[model samples]
Target: MAKMKLRVGVIGVGAIADEKHLPNWQELEAEGRVELIGVCDIVSERAHEMAAKYGARVVHTDYKKMLADDKYDIIDVCTQNRHHAPITIASLKAGAHVIVEKPMAMNSAECRAMIQAAETNKRKLMVAQFMRFEPDSEKLKEVIDAGRLGTIYSANATYLRRRGIPGWGKFHIAKESLGGPLIDIGVHVLDLAIWLMGCPKPIAASGKVYRMFGDREDLCNAEWGEPYDRKEFDVEDYASAYVRFERDITLTMEVSWAANIENERSGVSILGDKAGISTSPLGLYGYENRSLTTTRFDWLPPQSGHRMEIRHFTECVERNRPVRVKPEESLRVQQIIDAIYESSRTNAEVPIKAT
Candidate 1:
């Protein structure tokens, strides 16, 4: 006998849906574990294209209409940074669970509001901080759990790219897109490092921000495809932070859209009492393995970060198990991100109010 399939609706059929979420859920549908039902986008054409391409039964341009359409077991939100809170709250109030992308909301306050709604409504809210589902990251988690890294002391997580700003509109320098690479890319490293370190309470944080190659037509670091509003470009292109945890552990994070580095540094390396482990773009490190020490996945997973997270969410809904990445845990990531922004502005160490 087989189990019942979970009905899932995905909101925002944009690049992330077409590229990551839809394809991932499609694979789950193929495996007969979940039923892909609805897809919504602000642009009707995109919704239609995704529904047609993926065989979803329902499609809507308005998110409210989609939320009101049916009592879906899971609503996967793949929208921009600003829209996460409203849509998530509405879905929760409508009695449906939510799975949203990371930097959970525009700020820590929005994150708190969404969590409150979910708690009041008794619905599951899972933020897709997709890195936790990556094979390498999971392996690193296992390594730590096995106590191979014995009493991890410090870590450095980086998401540095050399002039590789995104080639989309507003994502580069638009605050309405909710800040720059710090929230856009830094959130992942911050969450990954903190999670790998047992989600320690971030006690204090200090950050530095710079706009080295920004605010000009000729100095635009991203692609020359979109007509950017030179006057409206007001976000930082580079951000770095230092964090101290309550457990006496510390972590350093560096993220950037455009930098002078030779290449990208997209990994987290934790130095422990016994050994050191590092991973990037692939599997985890088993620094204590006799033959495979200090080397994590030599090859990458065949799936994307969004895939693993979606699968975990769907399965958690099906089994009534806890969301692998809890809303509270994800909210902590947003909390740190907010602090980084504040610390950058004040040029002082900002204390994290929430544990």
Candidate 2:
């Protein structure tokens, strides 16, 4: 006897789908492990185009209609931030495992709802936090889990781009994206750092946000390749936050889409009692015999983050195993994000309640 090929459907055939999700599904299809059954987008043309290119047999403008097909074993929700919760919840109720894009949802409340829906339907819900699948990130997780960086106490995660405001999508709109680079890009490093730290429970957050350069046409660069309305850009261009966890562990994060900095830079540094680890040049720093030293691996296995994420989700669904990026972990990430936004608005520290 042979196993039936897993049937997969993707909603939101936009940049992320075109660039990452669809391509990876095509690879899985080529390997005879899964079938791309349908592609859906509000834009009919985009959906049909992706279906034609990616071997999906059906195209739909509405995701609900696609879900009614009941042929799909997995649904990939690549929709906007606001739609993550509804689409995921609905997909789970429709009896399909879900893999939604990062940040989980606009707020923690929505994350809780999505989690409940998954539980009610007995379907797996996974957040597509691709950074966790990257080569350097995997190596760092291996080291940290091995107790190499003993008793991790604090971490700093920063991702900054001098003039990298996204030109496409509704990233600058508060309703669409929830925030600027903090929610957009900051979520990546923040989730990575938290996951690497064994997901300590976040107790509180203090943060601030600034709208320094997003709305300035003169400051925004065309390198992102889209003409966005300067007047419509109303989200923060920079954000900084400090979070405390249950075990007295702490994490600090800073991220920007447009900052008047020396250069674009991004990195994460985790400090433990014995040693510390950093990414993007990926090194370990510690004291050896009362002398400071650094350790750098000569090579790490090259893996596509997006591909690994898609493959992992599909395998989890097929094998009845747990997903790497669990929904509860994503909820924790969302809780921190919610606290940061609340702290920024109140001009005071906001306490996070772990549910």
Candidate 3:
């Protein structure tokens, strides 16, 4: 018997779709594992361009029209943060498994709605927390799970850019992106660190967000994209937070798109009673025979996390297996994100009641 080919449809034809999702799906199609059925974007030209490149049979300016066809077996939602929930719920209700882009949605409420839709339709819904699928993350998880990082008590996640404010799309708008670097890039390291620590239930968060440098287009050290109107920048350029989790564990995180720093850097460090680990150099520190020791893995898997993430979702849908990045876990992450933003607003700690 031959394997069934998943008919895939992509809802967003933006940078993420073009860079991560489409390339992987195109490769899977070339391998005769799936079919690129259609591509949709509010911009018809972008949709048509992606469709032509990826061998998609149809192009749609509206996602609802594409969902009405009932030809897709898997729908990949790669739209902006605002559109994640609606498109995901619609896709799941349309009888297709879904893989949505990161930060889940604009808020925890939307994340819950997406989860409910997936449950009601009895379909798999996975978020694109691609960091979890990264080779280094996988190795770290293995070490932690093996009890090497005994009694994990705390973690510090930091992603800082000296002047890397994104100038594309609606990133500078709070309505579209919910928050800035915290939700945009901070979520990646935050999710990985929390996942490595076994997904502890978050209790509360206290944080501060700053909008200092994003509005200054005169800054000469941005990472990418052209200049945009400084007046349109309404989101935070930097965010710092401390989150308390169950089991007396804690996580401190810092992320920024624009900062008055010397250089850009990103990584996480987890501290345990018995052992500690840092991600950038993949180093392990512990006491061996009552002496301080350090270890490093010279052999790490050289795999593209985006490709692995897409392949994992496709295989789970094909085999009716559970997805790696569960909807509930993503909801927790969203809750933390929401609480952080709220904490920033009220200048007080916001409680996160476990679901």
Give the runs in model 2 whose Cα sits over 4 Å from its true position: none
Ranking of all candidate structures by their TM-score, best first: 3, 2, 1
- Candidate 1 has an lDDT of 0.81
Better-scoring candidate (lDDT), 1 or 2? 2
lDDT of candidate 3 at residue 161, scale 0 to 100: 92
> What TM-score does candidate 1 reach?
0.91
Better of 2 and 3 by lDDT: 3
Off by over 4 Å in 1: 1-3, 220-227, 281-303
lDDT of 2: 0.90
Off by over 4 Å in 3: none
Query: Across residues 83-102, which tens digit of lDDT does each residue of candidate 1 receive?
Result: 88999999899888899977
lDDT of 3 by residue, 195-290 (tens): 999999999999999988777657664457656778888899899999999999999999999888898899999999999999987888999887
lDDT of 3: 0.91
TM-score of each: 0.91, 0.98, 0.98
Top lDDT prediction, candidate number: 3
Q: Put down candidate 2 lDDT per residue, 95-178, tens digits, no spaces.
A: 989999987999998999999999998999999999999999999999999998888999999999987888887888999989
